[model samples]
Target: MGFFNMLLSLAAKGAVILFFLLLLAFLGYCLYIKRIHMKYDHIPGPPRHSFFLGHSPTFLQVMKEGKIIHDKFREWSEEYGPVYRTNVLHFVFICVTCPEATKEILMSPKYPKDKFLYKRLFNLFGQRFLGNGLVTAVDHDLWYKQRRIMDPAFSSLYLRGLMGTFNERAEKLMNKLSDIADSGTEAKMLHLVNCVTLDVIAKIAFGVDLDLLTNKSPFPEAIETCLKGMVFYIRDTLFEFNPKNRPFINEVKEACRLLRTTGARWIQDRKTAMQNGEDVPKDILTQIIKAASKEENMSKEDDEFMLDNFVTFFIAGQETTANQLGFCIMELARHPEILEKAKKEVDDVIGMKQEITYDDLGQLIYLSQVLKEVLRIYPTAPGTSRDVVEDMVIDGIHVPGGCTAFFSSYVTGRMEKFFKDPLTFDPERFHPDAPKPYYCYFPFALGPRSCLGQNFAQMEAKVVMAKLIQRFDFTLLPGETFEVLDTGTLRPKSGVLCSVRHRKYSK
Candidate 1:
């Protein structure tokens, strides 16, 4: 009985020790968070909702309310000036909407992409998605090398050569839309544009013929699922743990696998073709393989990097352009006057022409303005972020180092300070006589790391848009709100549903 009592007493003492240890750890964590909070105390921002979670709860509330997170940033920008700080958990993000700050941050290579953010993009739902691709590569040297290798494929001369492919793919879309128009059926313009862009990227970049408009392919759905998964995975830290999210998460993983596997098969085919001395187009895929061919035998890591670029080009090349076209259509449909003017321009420049040439693209000046205005309003790839490793003063406000600096075109483009009547969609803002927006307008982003496919995307977009306006007259279906959906990239929330009718001059 004495020994039993002693054992109980010892166990009680051990429990007390463990409890104290946990208490000490908690106290230490609180002190660390306090230090971080003190570090950014000078920057103006909304009040934190939680001592530990920082602004994360507020962000969650915004998401729950079905609003784009960037719109919240814009709201905060209005309240707290152009440059303000936001805390997501313990991480500090200095949101800069002013043109001066935008120029300083984006135009220089000194600020690399935020590793914290890009690393999250390296995988989605624990599946490798963009593993060290040109987009996700944080290392400047690595990105530069890959960019150099891929530059030839995007050269002005090379892109000029791709006009034929663009016309061919876009013509397929017209065929599909014609079917919808004939039956008087409503069409999802976003889906149709997505297929055309997918077909274009497959043909021009990888030299594959997906013919997505003609063939029902899993790729479109897979791409959509992966994009949706990317939003959930990147925004919510605990996304994978929730039982409710399991089914969607599984689909995301499967979608990622499909893209990577497809990339692998296509890559192997190209390599085999090269081995057999068969003629293969000198395309982006060829450059991707060349980028990783420094070693006699490619390592597993090299092979994965090749796949990373394959997925990156496919998603980035296809998704952003399609979203832009969808939003452009949405806006044009909303304003019949603007649609009429744009159609007139297309009719004059590309009348009765089966093919839209590179020279013809340059002559579509008003249409170019319309497309530019669309991006200003709905920058499909909304923003870019940089890691601020050194302290600096932005707009005379002291911003501390060791924070992420985010430059959003969406916020800046809509600000009253940057553009008059920011909410009004005015194509005249991009007129040749209008003074150019300093650094406030970057739909394709600005700087050394600007989208490599900016011209390619725009060229493809103009062809599709010109043909679309020339051939069909479309009206937004009733009940469409034209809300922007932020699924990684911005897209029309209602899928840009529209009813189409063949124009009198279509033939």
Candidate 2:
């Protein structure tokens, strides 16, 4: 009986020891997290994580709610200083909003966007075609090299040459709309406009006119596949956020698989034409070909890589430009005065009877200001990132190595301190020699990685807007707002629906 009691006592003691050990383990983790949290404790931000999970669950929750994580960051930015930290997954994410910090990040030769996941996703799209094209596809040194090679293609003179593509597509789109409006009188503007933009991008970027606006289902198969293919990627990325002994990294051997398979076929076809010494129409793709041909290092193996750029250009230029048009047009439909101002400027310059020319559109300064304002409010490309190359101090916060930082034009656009009324769609804010908005309102971004197609894009927008407003006066069909689906570009949450009427401008 005494021996049995001794065994029971021993077991009780062991149980107590086990409980204390578990408690200590938990306490240590708490202290580690607490120490890190306190490092930024004095800095204004949202509530720190209550546990080690930090902002991971919040990010997934935000995604589940179909909202952008940046929206939450914008709210936090109002209270926090220009630079603040938010724990995103295991990351101590730093967001910089001030102009100085923005310039430091964007213009720095060292900082590049952290595109680890995007690189893999892009590779799935086609690694070869996008191997070195701008925007997350290239490393910093390659980006600089690619930028230098591509700059001449978008020179003022080159941009002038591309204006006809916009004018041509806009005319076709207008006529198509006229036919539609004659029959139905009103239609969803999003898809039709997107089709036109894609066609235009295809033409300007590569000189291959798919005529997507007129074609019934040109990019249908590829677009569908590309869209669906991204799901596997998003799923795989979220899976990596778990810290509990997750193993394996996928080296997507086909960085340009789809792109190469499909894109290379086109590149091969184009090369054959060039091999026969045929005149490929002068487009951005042709320009790239010219550069490659001139490049001593370029080889047949590089064709897939070059074609990746064309695909990237197609996705990048077309997608963003299309969304911006929808957003701006929606804003115009909502605010009659803004639309009228745009119309007046167009009419004043081109005068209702004249065909809008690229050169003529440039003379319409007030119209340009309106577009600038639109870009500022609903920029095509919203937020961007920069990974700190070395230890750096941003906004007095000393960031350590491997820290990724960011600035959102989307967020900056809404800051009360940035603009008098940041949310309002007032074009006059961009009058020539306009009072500058603290250099923080970067829509196309600035320096180094600024949108390569800005000049071409602006030309396209000017022509499209001029022709569009002249032809149709749209009313937002009562009780409709263009919802937000902010991503690489901003878009209508539920599509910009409107009642369209053909405008007859009286002389």
Tens digit per residue, CA lDDT, model 2, 158-184: 887776778888888888878877886
Q: Judge candidate 2 at residue 465 and give its lDDT.
A: 78
List pairs with backbone clashes in candidate 2.
Answer: 123-255, 126-256, 127-255, 127-256, 128-305, 129-307, 129-308, 129-309, 130-308, 483-493
- What TM-score does candidate 1 reach? 0.94
The per-model lDDT (C-alpha) reads 0.90, 0.70
Question: Cα RMSD for candidate 1?
Answer: 2.5
How far does residue 349 in candidate 1 sit from its true spot (Å)?
1.3
Error of 2 at 26 (Å): 15
Off by over 4 Å in 1: 1-23, 291-299
The true-versus-predicted C-alpha distance at residue 83 of model 1, in Å, is 1.1
